[model samples]
Target: MCPLFSPPLFMQRYQFVVDFVQAHGSKKVLDLGCAECSLLKQLQYHGKGVELLVGVDKDSSSMKTRMHSFAPLSSDYLQPREGPLEIELYQGNVTQPDPITRGFDLITCIELIEHMQLEDVERFSEVLFGFMAPSAVIVSTPNADYNPLLPGLVGFRHPDHKFEWSRQEFQLWAVRLSELFGYSVSITGVGALDDAHTDVGFCSQIAVFNRKPSQNDPTNQHRSRGEPTVYRLLYSVAYPSLSDNNVLQRMLVNEVLSQAEQVKAAWLSGEWAAKMAGAREPYRQGGDICVSLLDVWACPQVKHLCGTLRRFTEALVGERRVPLTPDRQAVIVPTEEEDEEELDEEEEDEEEMAAVEARCTTTTTSVATEDWEEEITHSAVGELTACHVLAHD
Candidate 1:
């Protein structure tokens, strides 16, 4: 890794795969589920010395667009001095072998397995290990056990994921597959690993399988002459910086502040007043107002606002100055037992409130009167303070 140019953690994983391929002196390489061919681009940019680079994916549209966009950016670095790099794009399924020229030096299926059904994984493994007969195969998937470490994240990382495997589940599958095929498998991890005992720590798990010498020999009975259907050519260009965390962070902050200002204007424009006037007795107990405010906080227009939401909640909590309920005007400290129960309930409520606000913040373009604008600012402060008081009780 370059000290001056730090790629994001996910990109680092792709780099790791490339490094492993280069270290083993692999020349012919193939990537399965190569969406946007980002990894291939990175490999070329990093000068991995791959003579032939092939990428296959089910998404024909994206591949076509990427190929067109990146053609101008493709440089001499992607081509070897001895000969031009043979870059190929194919649309194919992993479960079934296609007419792709076999006997690759290295094959990679990074973050592609979890999209498959367990049965499909079995078929894919057979096709890869038996037919492809690469010297080395690298596969990566999410470690479900590490999900707890991500704040406010729930279920799978992506909705398209069929299922995520824990470390034990992944290892068990790898061992079984290695036994079925004539290969030796090693396991390693990617992404941050903090607190090893309690968490799997690494966000993604990887398996590297090296074929037995006899298995790689051309005389082996496992070798197959299947060819993959020629896939449509997409962009074969230099890797572009797809994303920057710092730039995204700045954009999110600016967007959140802008939305907040819009919210302030909406509040001053009597939007809340109109809703409050129509509310039933139960809804008038600040529940509707809390929901309304949270709707503003959770708008999807702002990107990566989980940390921002936490900060906003903390600020509101710190500025709390009034009681939550109108009837309970006086502050009354509770006994230890009561305090414990109240604390638990408060924590649950706070989490719920945060989730609601984080997912539902609405935007409005209505103008505000000067007097109402001042009142709305003060009212927002008071409401947030009251919500904080409710959460602390």
Candidate 2:
């Protein structure tokens, strides 16, 4: 009755979801788009051990199924029931703002995304994220490449489907999400579900979003300003400088702040016509920076990244984490790590090939962890808010 996630590879994911919710030791689960309420039944059937099971769907037919049973937990919070387990199923669409009754330990939206309207995707995503029980959200969706091999075979393939994504496409989004929202993401599983009748294999992609712990600059050990918010991306936390010792490098450019102020004031005062003697330096001097984040947390990008992470940390403390930056107005600051000496078009291509070869040599190489880089004790609080695109240039 729970998810027939019958595949051998997926058993790991089930264990993952179970262990994830048990971290905080709460027993409430809400399944959005709970079609046929199979997930609820599974919890009731298998989760006689699970804390709470709540299922929701928009189709009225979902109520006719044997899984629908509700008991009042209070006037507003009602415990659901199914078989020997306490389960609940509400016939309502996830698109509505008020469909969910309360927060849950883990919120799951599995394989049902393809059927929703393209525009509603973001809206409902936020709504669903709001329903997350403050721990983690486990999501599984179709890898766009897993499209039907024969289009007209079954009703499963819809011509009006909005868009699809490949592995890289999903990673790009995940990277951006983590960067923008300060959430940690890891791909949990990738598998193919075969619809033999259509000769098509639906590729399932799963990702886990875990909150990390809060940390502060060892320098500012006692101050509690909460986290800093970069209302607007003013700078890149890029390589501040390319030097052998990162601290020395940061100190060397300690003058950049004062110097940049003069430059910005000049540029902002309609005095762009006049150039300062120090303004001779070109934009974005690219390179490497070897500073450890523990001691100094003053750079704009560093501040933004860490501050956001702190908020997440404060939110999910003690929840459990296996463990695991920012923007620019327009100034392009380049760093030395990437400034590996550019080559002409042909030479550049060769360099890339050699880099790839070197990469292959160290493919399985691992590094020794320093004391500070050991197991984490802090936790982060974050929700997988799909994409908060406030502006585009």
Candidate 3:
């Protein structure tokens, strides 16, 4: 492990797989030899476009003990989902031919093959490339050549590793498999050392295998096969999605009320008043206070909310005064005027604030005042605030 990399070597290996899936838009992914489901935990959140993620490990007890690590959390509901994501964990051997996991977009066997007996390696390749042929596969293992570089280390990096392959040996094995399975293989590595021993290569060597597109491609041939699942399903979960009406309704209500309360707090704060002191128009028009749509988008409290979800919040602000102008840039919030009957409306507003405080416990942020001040100074506060308002129409 190098001092420069904070996450160290093992995490870098996982990150490489994540970056690959994100780049290629792999919708279905399988992780072989998943210990404690660490890669699954990372892939669930960071693996973009990953709709179906499956993990298999021979160590059933390890995967079972950490099943909760990949489950959806309380905060997952606050944000909208990219799409439907389903994760499943199973206990099984990698060399077995499992019908359920076949024809995936991508498969990863990270730092796993070195632990297998020499004879099982051939069976593992036959299962992955011939039977369960995915479009792409990534495999990483220790580089025996780099073992001597470590000051106190001797022999293999891990005691459990049956055999460690030198760079040439790993590439020879990979090239032979690529030829036999009709796939293309490329070699890369991680945990690079300084210039002095660059020739020795990375501590961890990797082989990326992509099935060659052809009439005889194994993946195409096996895409429709219906083999029974060999792995035992230990756990499964589907995350909440905006497509669900109840979920969307709850999220929409919480954000609208939270934003409304935030706007109100900003209007009352002395910093907001000081920022608006030089505006050309009065802060309030009749009974409505002006708010910037841009500022609302930038507010740290709701900053994590996506632009599309914000549109829903913008649309569902019923009965309040948050009507967008023709340009769809600005809005307004209605307040109480000096009329005697308006006292009732003011009391209602106070009660509404109290309710907002109770339902939304997220701390309000005042640090964005300077951002508003900078943008407001460039144009009149009235014009900017008029562009976007968070209120019920």
Q: Against the true structure, whose lDDT is highest?
A: 3
Task: For residue 294, give model 1's deviation from the true position in Å.
Answer: 80
TM-score of each: 0.54, 0.41, 0.65
Between prediction 1 and prediction 3, the one with superior TM-score is 3
Please give, for residues 194-283, the per-residue lDDT of candidate 2 as tens digits.
445223333456767654434621212221222212111111111111222322223323333233444444444556332322223223
Q: State each model's CA lDDT, in order.
A: 0.55, 0.40, 0.67
Candidate 1 error regions (>4 Å): 1-7, 69-83, 193-199, 215-227, 230-393
Q: Between candidates 1 and 3, which one is better according to lDDT?
A: 3
Error of 1 at 129 (Å): 1.0
Point out where model 2 deviates above 4 Å.
1-26, 68-85, 99-101, 130-133, 148-161, 178-182, 190-202, 213-393
Report residue 151 deviation for candidate 2 (angstroms).
10
lDDT of 1 by residue, 4-115 (tens): 1124345656777878976887777888887777777766556356766778887765565554433322232222133234466667676777646376888888888878
Best by TM-score: 3
- By TM-score, the candidates rank as 3, 1, 2
Question: Which pairs clash in model 3?
Answer: 287-335, 320-392, 320-393, 321-392, 322-391, 329-387, 330-387, 330-388, 331-388, 331-389
Tell me which of candidates 1 and 2 scores higher on TM-score. Answer: 1
Worst 10 residues of 2 by lDDT: 361-370
